[model samples]
Target: MPHIIYNINASPTSDAGVYPIILSGANGANYRFEYEAANLIINKAPLSGIINNCNRIYGEYNPSFSMSFTGLKNNELSPIWTKQPRFITYADKYSSVGVYPVSVSDYDAKNYTIDTIEDGTRTITPRKLVLKVNDSDRLYYQDNPTFTYTSTGFVNGDDISVLNKTPEFSTDATIYSNVGMYAVEIFGAEARNYDISYIPGNLIVNKRVLKVVADNKTRRYMTDNPVLTYTIAGFINNETENILLKRPIAQTNATILSDCGEYIIKILGAEAENYDFEYITGLLTITKIDQVIQWKQTFENIHIGDQIELLATADSGLPIEYIISGNVEEYKSGDRTYIDCLGCGEVSIRATQEGSVNYNPAMRVVKYFTISEDASIDNINSDDYSLNIYTKDGYVVNGSLSQQYIEVYDVSGNCKYHGTDKKIHVGKGIVIVRVNGRSYKLVCK
Candidate 1:
């Protein structure tokens, strides 16, 4: 058996190669017993490593970096590091959010070259930003106001001026829009340092005030009422009456047959979405009509007994009342008037009409006629005028004629008609009529 005296041990920091064993004394009888053939062999170690990705907020600094190694020979296999690896990234607190390359500086694994199967890297990520739009309002048919917004989470105390691209605000409303609700949208905002979130807002519209007034008018009695009208005020944004949902209505109680008086004209029933309405009233006046009486002053050609008509009319279409001045026979109620002159004397008639609510009173009017005895009433045998004769239209009677007196009697001296009348009405029988002292016989048939 060949016996060895000194030994050789493998260390983690030892170089991998063939080495000679240490010998202070040799036990070989033969001085050169295989001294060149006894040697220890070491193999090269396989190694691998990786650098991790990283992230952070926009306002924060970069965190520390690390690397993980794989495929070491064993737990007992440890490599001595001559120099450690150094890592660096382009991302910083104020840097834009994007993929940035991570690089390496100096790295070593003892005397052996380290085969880095995976490359090391440092990653940068975007921070959060809050953006919001402000609410706004305006009246109907008015121009739009300026829009604005508020922003938060800007890094380094930066404002909207630091943003490379900014969003815009818009709404569904316009200057000519009516009263309603509309949406406001925020869109298309961009910045290098942060991710954005938009908060929506609202646009409001209010109603406007409007005034309406009724018009005044006038008319006469028995006339038609005028057409009602009104006036409007306070319109905006080049608006017209055509924009109204329902037009205003004017009203009154007067008609063509209404009496003479004052009436109230009112305004109401107006409608519109964007308006507040106020109403006003007006007045209508009616006046009385003038009136006159058409009549004559005097009549002609009078006799002892006669029947005549009193003709009189009023322009107001009212009835005429006949007033007699002396003793005369008259009929009161009818469209026509008749009077009887019983005796020879002067007679007079007056006509008048009282006023009503829609007409003025007519003026008073009068007319007269004279009565006389006839000269042909006497016989031609003597030319003397005597007290025993009474004259009528064609002849003379036996008695004198009084202005209001006439009489008729029966043959037995019974008086039938004792009133003032141009004609006598009696029962059927043999009857005697007496005019003054003269007598006439009538037969019943």
Candidate 2:
């Protein structure tokens, strides 16, 4: 072995005194050594005390409350307090009403265990004040009014005058001159004994009583221009004493014309400073200068010798006069008119009404119809006069048929058959046939 080495360390100690250290080394053989260390000193552990006395804090008035502690020596440790219920760091000033605990601890932290002192609870209280105003009296236009109120914790002798504060209404008569609701408030009044809180009050101003009377009138169509008139009473000021109220401005959407209907005449923006005005609404009735009417009818698939009656209807639910002209003759009985289809042509019937007191001249509407025979055959002479017909059941041929073109139509003018064969099949109906410019009608039974 080259050389022997030894290392040593001592455990941490709280007490100060002399102590011994032993060392051992080995180099092929065991050896031991001893030494004494001196002058080791350990300071005393920090001590903490309990706080027993605490001052009551007025959260509103005071900034902080002082505390007293016991069992602490020489100011060796500083007091660090905690607020209880919540157990947070203590604050100097208190703002809310509650009981809080404060704990004291040493400023110097030691490795050894230490004790802390918890103090008794500190109490905080709140102070509040409120003010209110009384405004139960009703006010009228052009009248001056006074106001009063009740209070809590605020005395009348505290040099407090409501007029010195910001008031919603003063003694001026103009404050109550309008017909509306008003709030009278007195705020920011300072008092010596207690805090002042403000609550607003209401004042209602009434206007002079008034009424509007309107007259009912009628207008004739395109003939008369009706003027809207009204009467006003209870005028309170010289501005309207001898003044005549003009007709109200008409609304943009209002229609007054000869269309024979009820119309509304509204008085817009009618007001007087000292007088309470009422909205005026009026009605005007209009009558037509002449009777007006309309008629509707559909003419389809009319046959010759068809006797048709024409009846005209009007929106006014009045009788309509009928006039017939064309290929048809009209027969009148009572209020009804009949038309006899004379031939295969077009005929027109018109509806009309003479002028009446409640209506303008009647507007006329005409209806037309075309008449035709059901089916008729015209004889044709052909060398190949061979004719063949086919019913829905089967085919039938008369004589020897030739290769001639054939076309057939229904009574409603719809083509039913077309071909070049002698025998053609068809459904059961009244059909018109044309072969090589000759025409015939077949009633398929």
Candidate 3:
């Protein structure tokens, strides 16, 4: 059987296993066979072009082979997720912001860059994206950036019409303040109060400040002191008192003399406080005595001895009361007769006594003797005199006169004694005796 029983193991197609062989007839070249390649021989299959080129499943080319597939897939599918639209950059650049999303149009795609974002089409940097609330761009890395709102009349939800501008009360406003606000009170359409919180920040400064001032006025100037005099207007008695005396005349109720020199009047000037001025209209004094007494004898045409009672009364001057005894002697001058004083206190003679028609003794001077009875003369005082005697112009009674005589008589008309006076003392009553055979009856005390 010449090995009609075929040894299939030896045949090149009998074993489906990996084999190494040499092609002897082809110049001894080396060849290798994979199990799948030997199976393709056992199945009598033709070689595919993939296997015909090279099969590098488990060699250094395997990793490099899968990488090519990945590069091709990336190049083809990249446009699906990576394409962008046009967007705006910040017209003015900002410093510290980074990239962020922004709105855009698809037509603006050429404006995009790598490190920016886009809403749907256009790309934008975060520094260029302006926030609606503040109109400030976003900083790339800033957590929160500074901003300002440009809306009119909008604040932090407070009812303040005036904003960052200065507040004015009226046209002519008055602001009452010290250096700064410790407290404040205001009244307008409403009453408002504030604490130190009225100041917001330290952004502004006051270079110059204001100040205040005051004014005043007054009145007082029209009265002080003057001078005056005093006098009396009326007096109690007119004839004997002085009135209208000078100021400070006397104390109240004091005695004073009137102008007419009559009766006394009381004073009324010293008790006044101010100056007492005077206007005296007329005489306010008692110038006359109230009453008079009359005595007359030897004035009849028939009766030898006539007598009438006379009462003592006050008159202008002094008058005496006495009993008319006898006349010592009598003389006629003009139409009047004068009799010397006899032993009585007085003697009376008239113009019609013993057939006398006219007698005027106004120019006659008489000398007579004086007499005395039992009366002592020293008992009379100075106030009791009937006449105030003064010597006639250039004639005076000095020392004593000699040749004087005296007579003594009784009440019955009988002569008691007559003698030349020797040492007839003064202040003694004496009786009269005349010389030349014309003795007169006179007495003096």
Best by lDDT: 1
TM-scores, all candidates, are 0.42, 0.30, 0.15
Candidate 3 is scored at a TM of 0.15
Q: What is the C-alpha lDDT of each candidate?
A: 0.67, 0.53, 0.26
lDDT of 2 by residue, 13-54 (tens): 333233344334543445443434333344444444444444
Give the least accurate 10-residue stretch of model 2, judged by summed lDDT.
80-89
Q: Which candidate is the best by TM-score?
A: 1
lDDT of 1 by residue, 1-445 (tens): 5566766765665677776666544565656654434567776566776767666676787787766666555453445567867776777777766666666668776534567636554555667788887888888888777777888788777789867788888888998777877778887788777788998878887778778888888888888888888888988876777878999988889887777888999988888999878988988888788788898534677543345677788888888888885435565435877665544457678788877888877777878777543322221112333223233342223342334354544434355666555434555443433333333343332
Cα deviation of 211 in candidate 1 (Å)? 2.5
Candidate 1: residue 153 lDDT (0-100): 85
Q: Who is ahead in TM-score, 1 or 3?
A: 1
> Which ten residues in a row are the worst by lDDT in model 3?
210-219
Ranking by lDDT: 1, 2, 3
Error of 2 at 27 (Å): 76
Query: Per-residue CA lDDT of candidate 3, range 296-332, in tens?
Result: 2323221111122233222332333232335434444
Backbone clashes for every candidate come to 1, 5, 47
Question: Candidate 3: deviation at residue 251, Å?
Answer: 8.9
